[model samples]
Target: MLLQIKRLSSSYGRVRALNGVELNIEEGELVALVGANGAGKSTLMRAISGVQPTNGGGIWFDGADITKVSASKRVRLGISQVPEGRQVFSEMTVEDNLLLGAFTRPRLEIDEDIEKNYVLFPVLKERREQLAGTLSGGEQQMLAIGRALMARPKLMLLDEPSMGLSPLLVDQTFQTIQKLAESGMTIFLVEQNAYVALSIATRGYVMEGGRTVLEGTGQELLDDERVKKAYLGV
Candidate 1:
């Protein structure tokens, strides 16, 4: 396994957010965690990324235990997260925001990585000198993903890449994720759009009220009657 979460549990004061959630993802696999609001999907991503502290659990990545690792160190260890909101610096240029993602690396590598990101996101290339705050919602989301990629991560955690977008933009975002997966990027996606998510994911888990209630191949989940009734609305 490239990533594993064993009996993960977390709480926000008296509110228990995650209840012994368990999950696993293989290298280069695209996995999705789908759930409704307040299902603890974002909390799970935060725990894996080492931002939100866990009460009790183990997070193993690339065969090493990172449960207690610092968030910055985790990024250096090849774990990067594109947070739920497209948290781009509005005043900063697109290139500058991307450069921030490579802060842990040497200065020389940062330039190289920025060029690579530009190639991956041609729109960003055109807006390289433009302020990130000026981009459209979908474009900003793309920039967020691009910024995360700048870190050269072995495992990328994404929180709701499709949130707050038009139908057309949503389709484009899913296509971009599929392209990334085809290029051998390992991804753990937290999304509310179950249908689109499962379509691109290799495997998936369903969360309800801070617990993982279902696990299976993406196709299996898509075909599941329960999943259809609740999430897919089929």
Candidate 2:
């Protein structure tokens, strides 16, 4: 497995957010995690990325235990997270924001990486000198994904890529995600839109009340009666 979580639990002070969550992602696999708002999906993503503190259980990446790893170190170890919100550096130019993602890399290789981002997100190249804050929501989302790719991560954690997008932009964003997965990037996606998320997933898990309540191939979850009733609006 490229990533593994065993009984992982996290908390926000007195409130428990994750309850023994277990999941795995294999190399080059596109795994989707779907749940409703407040279902602890984002917390689980944070825990896996080593930003949120864990009270119990473990996280293993590429066969190494990294539950105690710092967030920066996790990034260096090839785990990159594109958080729930776009969270772009509003004051910085588009090129500068992309440069920041490669902070851990050698300076000599940074420019090459930046060019790669431009190729992947041509709009960012066009707006290289523009401040990130001025871009439309969809453009910012593209920039966010481009920034994360600059890290050259082995596993990409995407939280709510479709949040706040127009229906047309949502469709475009997911098309990009599907292409990324098809090109062999391993991804762990957390999303509230069950239908969109599951439709592109190789496999999927359902989170409920701070726990993973179901796991199956994408089609399996889509075809499941309970999933249909509760999430698919069948």
Cα displacement (Å) at residue 54, model 1: 0.7
Q: Tens digits of per-residue lDDT for model 1 on 1-234?
A: 999899999999989999999899999899999989999999999988888989988899899999999999999999989999878988999989999988788888888888888888899999999999999999999999999998999999989998899999999988988999999999999999999999889999999988899999999999999999999999
Clashing pairs in 2: none
Error of 1 at 44 (Å): 0.7
Stretches off by above 4 angstroms in model 1 are none
Off by over 4 Å in 2: none
TM-score of every prediction relative to native: 0.98, 0.98
lDDT of 2 by residue, 159-205 (tens): 99999999999999999999999989999999888999999999999
lDDT per model vs. reference: 0.92, 0.92
Q: Where's the lowest-lDDT run of ten residues in candidate 1?
A: 101-110
Clashes of 1: 0
